[model samples]
Target: MGAWVTRALRNFNVENRAERELSKMKPLSAPRHPSTKSLLQEQMSRHPEIEGEIARKDDKLLSLLRDVYVNSKDPVSLKVKDAGVLQESKEFRLPIGHHFEMMNIKSIPKGKISIVEALTLLNNHKLYPETWTAKKIAEEYQLELKDVNSLLKYFVTYEVKVFPAKDKKALQPK
Candidate 1:
């Protein structure tokens, strides 16, 4: 992992565990077509308005889920208050993609998340914090809105080819 990503993982207590699992996971297959190259793009194409949202709420959600699985030291007993699957599962929760999908976001791929994309999403999407429409993003993702807004922002920050609606040129100040 790159230095910055390693630093970013510091935000999660399960860095070691996630890293271990990630290391064991298979590498992503190359995209055959450029248009189909990015998951972020597919996500954005699904929910174009998601572009303007910030990453704070998504950070909060990550904190909460991490608290349950990592910080709390109860990876197995992590129970999400309103989550049906968490409620049903009697085992500690692992940082799996299921929850992210439920929330309409996803982790950047094993080697893809980087500083450049991070800046784009943070600077641009962060500008539209409360205005982000999760439902809209979710519709594009064909998934729930649990953490989609923030994830999309991250994807956008990384320049994942997520389509954007062309904004009208600003009116002249003259």
Candidate 2:
């Protein structure tokens, strides 16, 4: 009876030791890759051309973002007026003032004037009708008359929309 009891105690001790060893065992894990920033830095250092490639890729991404933002925020339909393509309308409609959204204008130092500048010139002189002419805008902005005319034409076609009505006469205050 003593021998049997001693054997049972030994077995119990072994089982507890085994359980403790199992509990302390760590899981097998795969090796982890380097962080993204570190990997990119390593690649850039290894291959110098990668820097330029990255810059070009960033530029392309920036241009794509600009196009998306500009087109989505301020949508405009292109119209070829010189080709005589017009929307079907039986009556003329008055142009709504101050309805168009302001466009993003990029400033260029000592470069050709953009449509935004021309529009700004026209917008600045709202009180005077004489300054609204293309000639005046061209002279003020030091741009060619043709350039100013083209910008004005583009503004009228894109920014201003014509609403059609059944009556041709002007609206009278009732």
Candidate 3:
């Protein structure tokens, strides 16, 4: 029994030692090729005339770019004085007031409502569904009736619930 136990432990130690050595060994990397920058330098050295041609093309390109920059500096007028007057209509006006004065007044795209308006509409629909129906909300916010119906059906405000502890002793602070 002693001989058998010693032989088993010796085999286990040899196997463990081999595994430890294998784990410590690093993987070998593949051979590398010459870098692109070095290859480009060698090619440029062989063609001396190509260097002169490149310089000439670069100078021509710089001149063209300078001409464009000078021309762009002169502001092109949109002739706002000659343009047609903007029609004042309810359709053009925003349903909500602006937080700040806008420089340019542009009409909002059709079938869109602000985040604040959407929340208010949802809250109203939730509290007073009969008064603030999908039809009323659609007319008030200038949204499609189908879209308003979908919003009310799918979206909901956060609902919080609190549960009391089963044991009165557990509620007491340590």
Candidate 4:
């Protein structure tokens, strides 16, 4: 056992020394690519006409921008008189009574029912379990049968249980 322990320690130290030597060595450098500046210089030297074309386009753009700036400086060129006038010109009032009626007429999307509809469904299912089974409810509401089964299995309406007072005297009307 003593010889085995010494041999294990010596092996561990030798492995650690190898690792340390590897860590001390410098990493190999990555291959270099020419810089963007040098590449651009080479490209410009190859195509001198490109430089003249770019200058001409830049001058045209500058003149157009100057014209736009001058036109923007004259308020009459812009259709909007005052900022407030622009806001006042458009009507933002929402349609009231009739819009709600139209919305109610819209069909409910599949797999979804309104809160009132959900409550009604739950109440009906509870009151008439046989008549409003999960299959029937799912068909009527356009919901998945599994969802209806889960809903029926887990959820319940508010049940108010009235517990009598602990003492009989407390129950008597004052």
lDDT (10s digit) by residue, model 4, range 1-174 = 999999898888797799899889698767546677688788899998988886575768788888884333656645665766876665342222233464644444567776667788899998999999999988887789989989888989986777778896676544
* TM-scores, all models, native as reference: 0.16, 0.24, 0.37, 0.40
Clashing pairs in 2: none
Could you give the candidate ranking by lDDT, starting with the highest? 4, 3, 2, 1
**RMSD per model, one decimal:** 35.4, 26.0, 19.5, 19.1
In model 3, the Cα lDDT at residue 151 comes to 94
Could you tell me how far off, in angstroms, the CA of residue 76 lies in candidate 3 after the best superposition?
7.2
Could you give candidate 1's per-residue lDDT for residues 43-95 as a string of tens digits?
A: 88899778767423677878888778444465544455547774455333222
Candidate order by TM-score, decreasing, is 4, 3, 2, 1
C-alpha root-mean-square deviation, candidate 1: 35.4
Candidate 2 lDDT, tens digit per residue, 81-173? 533454332233222233233543323333155445545665654446575787876666556788777766665422555666558586643
Question: In candidate 3, where is summed lDDT lowest over 10 consecutive residues?
Answer: 81-90
Two-way lDDT contest, 3 vs 4, winner: 4
Off by over 4 Å in 3: 1-110, 169-174
* Candidate 2 error regions (>4 Å): 1-111, 114-116, 125-127, 157-174
The prediction achieving the highest TM-score against the true structure is: 4
Candidate 3 accuracy as TM-score: 0.37
Note the clash tally of each candidate.
10, 0, 0, 0
Q: List the residue pairs that clash in candidate 3.
A: none
Evaluate all candidate structures by whole-model CA lDDT and list the values in order. Answer: 0.53, 0.59, 0.73, 0.74
**Candidate 1 colliding pairs, count:** 10
